[model samples]
Target: MVVDLQARLRDALAGSDVDELVELGCDLADAGRQEQALACFQRAVDLGQDWIWFNVANTLRELDRPTEAVTAYQRAIAAGQSDAWLNLAHVLDSLGDLAGAMEAYRAAGQAGGQPEGHVQLAHLLHQQGEPQRAQAALAPALQRGYLPAVALAARWRWENTRESADPVLEQQLRAGAGVDGSARADLAELLIATGRREQAREQLQLGAKLGQRECWLPLGNLLAGDDLSAEPGQEQEVDGAEVDKAGAEEAYRAGIAAGDEWCHHNLALLLLQRGDVRAAEEHLLAGAAAGDELAQLAWQDLHQQD
Candidate 1:
């Protein structure tokens, strides 16, 4: 009886429609026959299973075929699959088709897929250098709790007004204490920008120990005093110059071994401070060649001094 039932099930699947084929392909994909599963999904789409087109598109994307995935996602959209629009936008962005990605994101926003879509659109707009449009795009997300309003507000205050006048920014900065790597890094940067160098250093030290690569550059710059590019009012002089110099040198050395460009630049500055112009030039050249703008500017400044 069991054998007969199994055989009947196999026969039924063998004569199945596009939807069944998609289900089989999904099973195959879950079982790790990714290539064969993709082929099966493609066959389902070719058989006009419009409802499964989005799933096929997502599978194609997982298989690293962004261009084909975009086409499949477009087909799904044409078949009235609104939910696939965000995935389509992400695939376009991954393919470096930023314009198309933005258009898809806008469409997704219009379809009311996710409130976060508006925030993503705003971020993309900001990346494209349209801050005003970005701000406008964020309005919906801001109202709907999809965006980090407090953080965004703090950032805006820091960017546009005096830090001293912005109590909210200070509160936000304090609220970020003991957070994860990214939050700690952000807080460190804000601290440095708001003239809390010691606090920034402490935060960065904690971040570095916690494996945050982003903190290394700012910490290195602070150590070297070469290009303390902290925002206005953010500079802090060390109490004991010699001890600070030694600590900075050690940090820079470790940072250089970790392949940090800012560390290389800081090391160069340290070398220059120690009157080793030739060695400083070598590090400066290396950092500049690696496309560090600060290093390039520093190298040019040093060349002018020469």
Candidate 2:
């Protein structure tokens, strides 16, 4: 129906206005008609509108043609659309053009790009062995109240300030907990490392209540009596007291709803232990789709008979 309406509009108006064409392109894109969307965007581009170039680049990227996306993005930049540079940098990174990606990221920052672009630029700089520059890049994001940057800056400061689990570190972590979910998760981890299982459980429960979904996995495991060992075959110093499975299931379901991929894997294991193979398989497939390695392995094993 959208395609037919687009055809009627094109015939009625003779496709003069670039905005109308772009709107139609967006509608087609939303409807998953990529080929038609691409055509509309290209027609707008041929009519020499700068902003339409971004749409063309996005469609190219969605079609898995990142090379063409790079060209379109560059053209968009030339046509006074500097905001497309960050997306161009992402495509460049995927194609292993790190030097180009770094340059584009810097250009994006100069163009008043989003804080996330600065975060990615800092990460790339860090990976390239430029720690000081990476820290410098993160400064702007921290000032802008980017939570991940705030958490990362807190951690870096903590690393430089203390060598072990000290009262100061605990205080700082707790202070940052209200600002970053990672801070809460880190506090829980520090408690666990110090053999404070009861404190860790409380911290994790608080973290979950504060919307830290990743906390649920550990919370669920703590409820289910599973040892949070560093590795398989390692002895855990935790007490062997088990809580109710009902609570564990509740935590796992909360994590799954909050988009934690590994929660599906953990919940599937719990379901399987309770002899619900069909339900377990359903969750295993969901986790696999979300890129959980353990879930992929479990899914392969479960389907080996088929």
Candidate 3:
């Protein structure tokens, strides 16, 4: 089906102007013909469609040709596509040019000043050890009601300032999570940090049901015998019950079906414990291909043992 679609796109591109070529290139890229898409985008660029540089750069990035992507992205900015600078930051970051990426993100922030852009800028700033600036950057985004920004701000407060999340912030997150499923994962994190494991588990389950890919890992962790509660201000043994293996297995499979890489790693561990070595290896390979470092280590260990 994809092959036929690509062939049709090629036929269309044969007589296409710059705009038509870009459209066809977009279709090809969406269809997973990354190299063909780059070719079409390059043809548009050759025709002096400077605006098409952004399309060419995106396709190049997808093809793992980041150097060419950087050049094309620069051309895009030169052509007055200021928004291309935001995407350029991503490519630069992938190329390990953190300084360049930060500058590009700053440029993007100055131009658009959107919540999402500020959030990205803040994260990079935080990573660069500029916590003060990061906090300042997050203020606008948090006030804009960007759910992720709220969670990030809470995390910054908890981690950097050695302070607990303020009650108002907690309440705000809880209210947002109640109506917006996407916010549930972040709410669960806050709840977990505050020793409200039961509430956190409930939020995680709801998040998973809502199809949040990241919710599965923490949910799986909670299901894997981490549900014990300690008495306040004491180290005491709370009885740990065996987890429901079947339910966990189901959750793992659901996450795998959703294309979550971490799920493959978690599911592989369960399969290995159950002596299903072959299936465990299969999942480990999938996870490794998806760039899970732990999965790659596990796969190597298995081969070494053999």
lDDT of each model, Cα atoms only?
A: 0.69, 0.79, 0.75
Tens digits of per-residue lDDT for model 1, 208-260: 77666666666666665534343333444653332356667777776676667
Which residue runs of candidate 3 sit more than 4 Å off their true CA positions? 1-16, 160-165, 175-186, 189-198, 224-306
Estimated TM-score per prediction?
0.66, 0.67, 0.68
Ranked candidates (TM-score, high to low) = 3, 2, 1
**Candidate 3 lDDT, tens digit per residue, 183-259?**
56666767767777778778888888777766776677666544323222333221334465566677778878877
Against the hidden true structure, what lDDT does model 2 obtain? 0.79
- In candidate 3, the residue pairs with backbone N, CA or C atoms under 3 Å apart (3 or more residues apart, or in different chains) clash, namely none
Q: What TM-score does structure 2 among the candidates reach?
A: 0.67
RMSD of 2: 6.3
- Clash statistics: count for each candidate: 0, 0, 0
Q: For model 3, give the RMSD to the true fold.
A: 6.5
Worst 10 residues of 2 by lDDT: 227-236
By TM-score, the best candidate is 3
Minimum summed lDDT over a 10-residue window in model 3 is located at 229-238
Off by over 4 Å in 1: 1-34, 46-48, 62-64, 79-81, 94-96, 147-153, 173-186, 192-198, 205-212, 223-264, 271-290, 300-306
* RMSD, one per candidate, in order: 6.8, 6.3, 6.5
